[model samples]
Target: MKRRDCLKAGLTLPLLPLVQKAAAATGPRPAAGLTRVRPGAAGWPGTSDWDQLSRAVGGRLSVPVSPFLGDAATRSEALAQLRNPFFIGDQPALTQTSGYHGAWLSRPSARVVSAANSADVAAAVNFARRHRLRLVVKGGGHSYHGTSCAPDSLLVWTRAMNQVELHDAFVAQGAAAGTAAQPAVSVGAGAMWIDAYNAVTTHGGRYVQGGGCTSVGVTGLVTGGGFGSFSKAFGTAAASLIEAEVVTADGRVRVVNADQEPDLFWALKGGCAGSFGVVTRMTLRTHALPDTFGGVSLKVRADSDESWHALVVETLRFCRDTLCNPHWGEQLRFGDERTLGVSMVFQGLSQDAAAAAWGPFVAWLAARPQYTLLDPLQALALPARHMWDADFFRRHAPHLIAEDTRPDAPRMRMLWKGDQSQVGWYLHGYASAWMPSGLLDDAQREAAATAICAAAAHMPVELHCNKGLFGAPADALAASRATATHPAVLDAFALALIGNAGGPAYAGSGGTVDEADAREGAARVQRAYQQLRTLLPAAPTYVSECDYFQRDWQQSFWGPNYPRLLAAKRRYDPEGLFVIHHGVGSEDWSADGFERRR
Candidate 1:
């Protein structure tokens, strides 16, 4: 078989390519490579193969099996864990459970080798390579593109490898000469952000730049250039990375760091996980914990179309400029029916500084500029009473910084549901993109305006940015000396203005819609937002947050870095054992995996 052909010059944007139905890959004449595997292909660890794999991994394999149905006790426990579609990272969620954000986008292969350590992982890789089977690496199991798990592949489940270690000084050899080695945290790939957070706090004052959600896996977040409230203050999660222990395609455990296997080191950070190799553990730089402040939850309610658009634009601006102190962080959420909610926090900002920072933003929200000269009756933005009482906001806002995932914390969701009390709903889908800091050009804004107005219903959207991620001794927005996060991350935080965009999908009446109309609606949504992506050329969406259906995905995900990344992929994974959909070397594989792309 052959590798990806990306030598074609120039960027070609395919806004939305046709998604072909799954078919077993065949008819490939790529010399020197193994047979290409596809979804629904017939091949696997049949009973004997399963037993061998189980033995190889010391009985760590998990497969679908029937407990005598008559045994009520065993059956009851099994049903609670295995069949739930939305269970978030519970041990027995979907074979392809999307870590903490289980989207259930694809069915998973029924078999998984729950490898405990790097040696076990290496053995599994050699097994998959020997059989020419499609493989997926499930570090946190949370995959936006579903690359972490697949339907007919041998999955390396790393959920059990939850280990955390802290070091006082992590000397990075390849750091630019003047840079000093800093304290570091070494976390297992399967460990969640909370685990790392606990370790940092226990170490006394340090914190790692990572997911706001406690359950988000450190490995997955960093792989896609992790951004959070603290990111602007520190840098991206990827940038903070100092070292990693990886299991490569050749079944060797390699220590990858700036001085070790530098190219692989570069590819791992922001180049994304699963595309290079399985990262068993990661060591990242940590920052001293600073004083943190929280802002009140401000709700902006708008009853009309003009009001919603203006509110979203203004709120984003507030986050971008008005309150954009490097030490401060906030979340801007847009809910259905033109409603906007904001939750903010700050660290190391004194009360007086905090008040000064919130001053202009609050005043602007309380008194909005009028958009028209004619309509005297319509209040400019949200009516006074409808806006969350500003005074109340000033008094009751939170002091917490990172997400609180305790049982009663608002962000906590019980991944394991024992009864009807758990929340349940269908997620239509979630799509996001990065917007460079700037107003949408007229045409782009108009398109969003038109789409939102015609949309069947209100869409939940959010605009998030880490003002701190853009800071530095030099220019925070400039490329970092530490890790390989895309430089586009430093561009103004303009979120692709997704129409009907982000908090959560609004579920409607229980009636089902015509499948054909649903498809049409999806197409329309894709076109409307895809156009918006075109306007913001400077800023690319975070690879982890955005959908993979954009035009020229490789360029959009990684600009000038694509060529270099492709070269590295060719060098490290020669047979292309690691492939992320639309990732570095993925151009070589067809979307269906049935044919290699030219």
Candidate 2:
């Protein structure tokens, strides 16, 4: 089955009907005493009416859609001219455009506006408030559970809000302040990591809170717990936050930070996903930039069978265990490749010593005589750059790139889904894919090894240790912060290249892995996370991994901070006129009814 088919199967869970009924009972009930707030419909409006909404919002919204999402002649045209709005239908291509490699576009109920400025976001929020409508906020559209954008729900796109503000040595100022009085940055929610990186780096090698993927949005990434390469050396992205500027559901603009709206400030840091409000900008602490060493590429073959897998798996496990050691600054990416190479970067250690320290892993791969490591730095002399501003995205995209592209392989088909596991050890289960059948176990593994060798023939598998992937130290960030409630959350990215997946455009790559193959690949990943949990026994928890897993809004992402968030919501949005998809504040029921009336 294709990945979409498996995901579609997920919609058919036995308890789906019961879940829907239960949701209807307590889901987004009509606000008490508020005639304006009506029960929202379950799904989005039809696709044909999308343009009417685009025209309705008019210049108030900023999105990529060119008035063609609803009237395009072909799928490509529709996708090319797509932008988000409440009445707009879901764009399948844009669904999976999130930070996590695993998370992909499933289907949304409706589209929302992508803001270019704070006023634009304010307009959307206020509009929702006036209409008693539900809203969803998207920054980089990278949430694992597709929480950022909702179908039928009024969506707020922060992409147009991408702006980087650089200040003096101490702090980088953004247009949107976390609070009215505090000195913070006011960033457009849509800005990507690379944007921030360039802004900071251009101004005297300064550093700000960001993550590994250059394309991830600052708003959603920080709110959902930003993790990146510099994290272990620095801290989780949220810890560096000084303030946030947000547009409340009731269309009120508030600044949240340590001093002003302190409770809301606490909520905004890690606790605020799409709930509290639309984060238009943030003021983040700045760090002096440091000279670092790293690389991004793919490694395929190793001398022996056990050595290649062991080198990849064990090296990853070791890196995870020793992340806080201070001497190592690393990120990893391993897939259907051999001898995955680590893009090793070290700041605390000397250059010569860092290379020597990484020598053991290198020697291990070298022992695999059959393994042919294609070091990009050695071959093409490409220097390792940080994930934030690297030139990888434009080159590889949808799926192929310099890191793992095969020239003669079949076209690649990729499906990405995200999960967080609490496992700490790494393990392998080669027997599962061919299990039950066990027909060509030996021959298959060998062929697999050959393929691995072939892929690595061009470039080595570079371990891009996604910085800040793990939630911040719970003790340091506090439960009041968003990530504190959801500790050990790691972004698991699953990517594959297959034939005929991208239609006829780039089908000549010759590398193709279909749905069944992808499932097997995912199973391999599951086993890896599960076994790693045994070793470290502290892997991140993925909401989709378990059947009973439900994103309770307050608990899974916010934890014990729900009461405080609810209190803030009540104070800011008394009428409950503005609600959001997922579990946001929809379940709260104060005695006098929902709070905040505009």
Candidate 2 Cα lDDT to native: 0.43
Which parts of model 2 are misplaced by more than 4 Å? 1-58, 61-93, 96-116, 169-185, 296-323, 333-340, 346-351, 364-598
> What overall lDDT, based on C-alpha atoms, would model 1 receive against the true structure?
0.55
Considering every candidate listed, which one attains the maximal TM-score? 1
Query: 59, model 1: CA deviation in Å?
Result: 1.8
lDDT of 1 by residue, 483-520 (tens): 45545556544333332111111112122334454455
For every candidate in turn, the CA RMSD to the true structure comes to 9.7, 11.9
Clashing pairs counted in every model: 20, 91
In order, the Cα lDDT scores of the candidates are 0.55, 0.43
For candidate 2, the per-residue lDDT at 397 reads 37
Quote the lDDT for 416 in model 1. Answer: 16
